[model samples]
Target: MWPADIEATARAIIADFTARGLKVATAESCTGGLIAAALTEIAGSSSVVDRGFVTYSNEAKIEMLGVEAATLAAHGAVSRETAAEMAKGALARSGADLAIAVTGIAGPSGGSAEKPVGLVHLAAAGRRGKFVHREMRYGDIGRDAVRLATVRTALGLLGEISQEP
Candidate 1:
């Protein structure tokens, strides 16, 4: 279940991608498969949604999305580097023309001086090297709020990437 704005955005993406004959894949970490779930929640989403990877753990990110261990080691799982790699990997592995990745620490815990609980990194990659990255600091919001905000931002990134020629 998604809010009205989120569901609307997902529907718009599905329709636009279908019209453009473009497909998308998702590689998710903290938001799990919510991006994919949002897209697939719409009717006829199968035409635009290729696959979804719920890579919640480091091993899953490495194994499923081909995220490098070194990148994870250097930048941690929630960094821009890992998010970009995840997006690129998803695009390479799937039939989709576009891919988006989301990694974050959404928690009442897991806060550090550098990486706080509401810190999120999102990346979108498209064919022909089209890419975009966004880092959001949503403050110490509740876990659900943080995750929902992430889904919204991730969808926006996908929309932005889709606009590229």
Candidate 2:
């Protein structure tokens, strides 16, 4: 039930993280924990994946990841700010060495003039205070495609961070 590219990325993340003796957590919105799912599909991911938070709603993001209501109101859930907050929260709350967060609109609907569908914001944070964020516009790529693309990018972020000394 996982894409090949995503599965490959996840396996690489698991390998890199395990080698580094680091753990990972995920805070997901649009991808709905698909990154976590991909990692867990690996045979030995338990040694690397700490947890996955499927914060699919604004309320869940607030309660689970400490995303502020004001932040959501000001920038909406799909913005980079919210994605950063979600990443920090996951890193803090899950006690993982690194965490990845994703938020987005992926759909045949939910498009606006400003924030259209297939707009995804991603963030990765490390406990040592390193952080990275990205804004991806997959552009009406369909929900499944957007979500899969998101998982790939998230895993890539995790891989990148894992390589850091």
Candidate 3:
């Protein structure tokens, strides 16, 4: 189940998407399938949610979403470039008019010299030639908190792109 505000946002997005005849897809990494799970938890979401790619690993990102090996190698998994490609790839692969991708280092342990825990990059693309991106540095929040925040951010990105003409 999703939290009250999260579920509310999902419902609103589904309603708006349904009204606008827009469908969405998700490509997720650190948040796993949480973004997809939130939307699908709502009733009548099937019409607006085309599919979700939970590309948690680099292989899955390449195989499922067509995230290039060079992108991953040069930028790592938790990066804006990877996030944008994931969104674009999902849009290309799915029937959706809009897609969102999330990549992040959400952890109690996966911090490094440059990429620290709770550093999430989000991106969304619309068939109407709209694109949006954001980077969140949530600090070393707990794994659950980081993941939850990512889900929220990802949904917000999707919502924003869906409104474009």
What's the TM for model 3?
0.97
Q: Which regions in candidate 3 have their CA more than 4 angstroms from the true location? A: none
The Cα local distance difference test for each model comes to 0.94, 0.90, 0.91
Pairs clashing within candidate 1? none
Please provide, for model 1 over 44-123, each residue's C-alpha lDDT reduced to its tens digit, 9 standing for 90 to 100.
99999999999999999999989999999999998999999999999989999999999999999987999999999999
Candidate whose TM-score is highest: 1
Model 1 per-residue lDDT at 82:
100
Error of 3 at 75 (Å): 0.9
Model 3's C-alpha root-mean-square deviation from the true structure amounts to: 0.9
Residue lDDT tens for model 2, 3-111: 6777777788788778878999999999887888999999899999999999999999999999999999999999999999999999879869999999999888887
Residue 47 of model 2: what lDDT?
A: 96
Which runs of model 1 end up more than 4 angstroms from their true locations? Answer: none
- Clashing residue pairs found in predicted model 2: none
